[model samples]
Target: MIRMIVKDLRINPLRTGLTALSMFIGIVALIAGVLVGTLGRDYLEAVNARLSGRTPTYSAIIDVTSVAGMQTTMTLQERLAHFEPGSASAQYHLNDLAIWASSGDGGLEIRHVAVTVTDAERTRVMPAPIIEGAWLTAADKPATLETVVNENARQYVHDGTITLARTGNPQQVPARVNGVIVDGADEPVIYVNAAALQRYWPQAWTPDGLTILVHPDAGVDDRHAKTALDDLLADVGAGSVSSWNRSDNADEYEQVIDFLQLGVIVTAMLLLAVSAIGMINIGLAGIEQRSHELLIRRALGATRASIAAQVIGSSVLLSLIIALAAVLISASLVWMVPWMMPADSPLEPPAYPYTAAMIAAGASVATSLIGSLAPAIKAIRLQPALALR
Candidate 1:
């Protein structure tokens, strides 16, 4: 039956080739749309993660105006002092202080840079792509405080030392620039170790805001983690303490991606439908042209089911070949995405989306089956007596 189907397809090469070509185009479009949508969504997710930290990250603002606020802030600091690593409340905390510092290269001009005083765990909570050097570590703490600067700061700052001093204090300290990172910040920013900053200039170590990130392996949900964090800082005598989760901001971006993917799927489906229509038309015409041949097969003891199988099998085989080719092309395109992106972009291209390829293959097979139905039915209905006529 397979040999007979192959022979019949080869007899009308132009018609078969045209039908296969149309279906092939549709499969390629479907695969491309899925690949683009999946990759685009992943890129957005990575950008969001870099800017706002990973999901479930909670940020709290401590109000320091009132007397109670001052006491609460002091209490929070006291609690942080006794923090033990690997405890039940093993949450990672990050704090930042905005300070004015002068560079030897800048001479008389002092630059305002945000100094993020955090531990090595900062990367696990809020990941920033390292551009030149490495992230902060315990070993980075020395007499000359090692700091990582963002891309904006690297414009004026080199891999050397910068002077840090309070606005009115005559005392100055030197901080070494160890590396550069992309933190998605518009202004100049520097990251330093909390212990090093506190040792050199305790006054400049005061945090303007606090960010608490719950560890994924901490075995606690967001609600419980937020409650634990609030309880930990409850001693802050501030007028009001407000907190928000990163997921709140991430939802908006996710909705936009969902809409885009929906549109792509719909468009791809339309293209497949058009291709299916072309296949159905060509299949029916081919059956009509080979009516006498089918009648001869019927006379040679071929059952209706066998004749129908031959027609449908030809379409399924052609579509399977097209689907495989389309998947290979789409995979190659996905692999080349990183090379196409700008060097400054922090978004890392994700791996090829195998789910999209599977979907495309399924759609191809279903479309072929649907398109071949009419031709299969027509082929089976032809009487054996027609061969004698």
Candidate 2:
């Protein structure tokens, strides 16, 4: 039976090629489905690790927010008069203000610039980067007075043991700039102890400049946070309270990935269906052409089950080859694709992803199985008496 199937295949290379092509396509789809899903999760994990590395500023930890109004039609002096020193809290429109402060060896400079947190870490800044002298720990130690400066800031600002203070004309408290290092996306930032920031400006904490922090051991609970924030700065008002959660963003990303994965599965199933059709056509056609050979086998006393097995086995052999080729091709594609290339990328071509390649192999088997269905059914339908004639 095996020898007969081989001879039959040799007799029709065209049919075999067509069968292989259909199976290959199905295998590729399956491989692609797995690669995209796995890689998407991996890419996100990489980004999170980088952003959450060692020390996360408020920006990475939070999202976009601001004071309520800016067109107050008042000068700086007018705004100052509104600063109710004794007042416990104040609230303003969330979309209205820039919140920034600078620490130099000379003193503190409050930029009050509009900025958003790009990324963050729960306790560890991600990507495990190098720090200048000391590391940021949750210890109650005074925030590192020795500062690390951003590469960009270092250009205009003095380096190597300099004093920090406000740069703009208005008077502000002075802080020391102890050291400097590259900030990455975490750059354009000034680091200061929460207490130090509060002490430095003495006046700015007014219902404004609210810094969001993690709840120790409890994790991020928005309701708990809202309550605590309100209690600490009650006069700041509910309007002043705003919340940001990394977990929330992560959840959203998960949902998108889940949707994409489902799409991939559906697509793979459809491709497999197409392959099944191709297999059935090829198998049945092959069986029809070999009716004489089958009759000879039956006349020679081969059992019906054996004939059936012979037909199915031929399809499996073709499928195995198809699966191999498809998997290799799919894996190669994945290896070549970068998870996060630059906006304007400049990199060499990639290689095949081994894991993805393995996944493609299974798709190959599935493709063959679908294609074999028709041939198997036809083999069973054969009339031994008609064939013997």
Candidate 3:
């Protein structure tokens, strides 16, 4: 029976080609969609891994104001001396410095950016790993009263660099373009020294912003930390107190990526169904065209069982050939594509799932068998006498 099927394939090359091509297209679609889904997942996962590196440093915001009749100078030096940050907090942080730009067509705008603590301090606590650039150093401080912006933040304003000045003044402070930084959030961020930051004009200013380095002390619960912070603020006799997770932005970006992934899966399934329909149609047409040949075989004493076996066996062989063709084409493309991408793009282990490929092959086999049934049944119903004539 297999020999007969092979002979028929050689004799009727056109029909064989049509069936194989139809399935090959469907298999290709299935593979491409799945690979793209895997790529998206990898991109997100890599981003997450880096962000996890930044979480321990617990970056937060604080804005404090002076009460009437304090009778004291509120210089940043005095402020840091006044209150000792816990071991978990950064001792010093950029306070009021921000990147100024148009808020997308608005006349003028500012992004609230701070230079993170020291390079070591930021690396310890960011919600994501820093990809490039160092924290603004003490020397990045004002011999000329300039700033160094964070890397990722540059994407929002300029390609690689941006300028900052007092919002309304003609004065422009030149910040030499430094390398970019990336945490998981992928935001438009900038960084500069706290003292250098004082030169920039901003809507608000405070000496009490706490970038604390909390201790590894086991007894410090959130409640304990909050009470301690409150006591610390009161004892220092200044500064509003608060602690915020640094990775909030990264979390939001990850959620958006996850939502997009779900959408791709839903859409891929629908598109795959469409392609499968095309394959099924081609298979059924092939069977229909072979009806007269089937009738001839019946006249030659072909059993109903043999005829059914021939039909099913032929379908599986054709599906396997198509699967092979699709696999070959996609594999070649994957090998070539990595070379064409930018060098800076993150390296990812692209997915080629054996289970998914098997499932797709099984589906193809099922589709082929289902496509044979109606024609096989019709062939069986005909009497040999009627069919032979």
Query: Considering every candidate listed, which one attains the maximal lDDT?
Result: 1
Q: Alpha-carbon error at 334 in model 2, in Å?
A: 4.0
Quote each prediction's TM-score. 0.77, 0.53, 0.58
lDDT of 2: 0.48
Give the Å error, residue 223, model 1. 2.5
The TM-score obtained by model 2 is 0.53
Superposed by TM-score, candidate 3 places the C-alpha of residue 5 at a distance from the truth, in angstroms, of 2.4
For model 1, the superposed segments whose C-alpha errors exceed 4 Å read 62-107, 138-144, 169-172, 206-219, 230-248, 295-303, 336-345, 381-389
> 307-379 in candidate 2: lDDT tens per residue?
7777777777777877777766665556646665542222223445566556566656655666666676777
Q: RMSD in angstroms, all models?
A: 5.3, 11.1, 9.0
Two-way TM-score contest, 2 vs 3, winner: 3
lDDT of each: 0.69, 0.48, 0.54
- Candidate that would win on TM-score: 1
* Candidate that beats the other on TM-score, 1 or 3, i.e. the better one: 1
Segments of candidate 2 deviating more than 4 angstroms: 1-8, 42-248, 292-301, 332-367, 383-389
Error of 1 at 78 (Å): 14
List runs of model 3 lying over 4 Å from the truth: 41-92, 96-114, 120-246, 249-259, 346-349
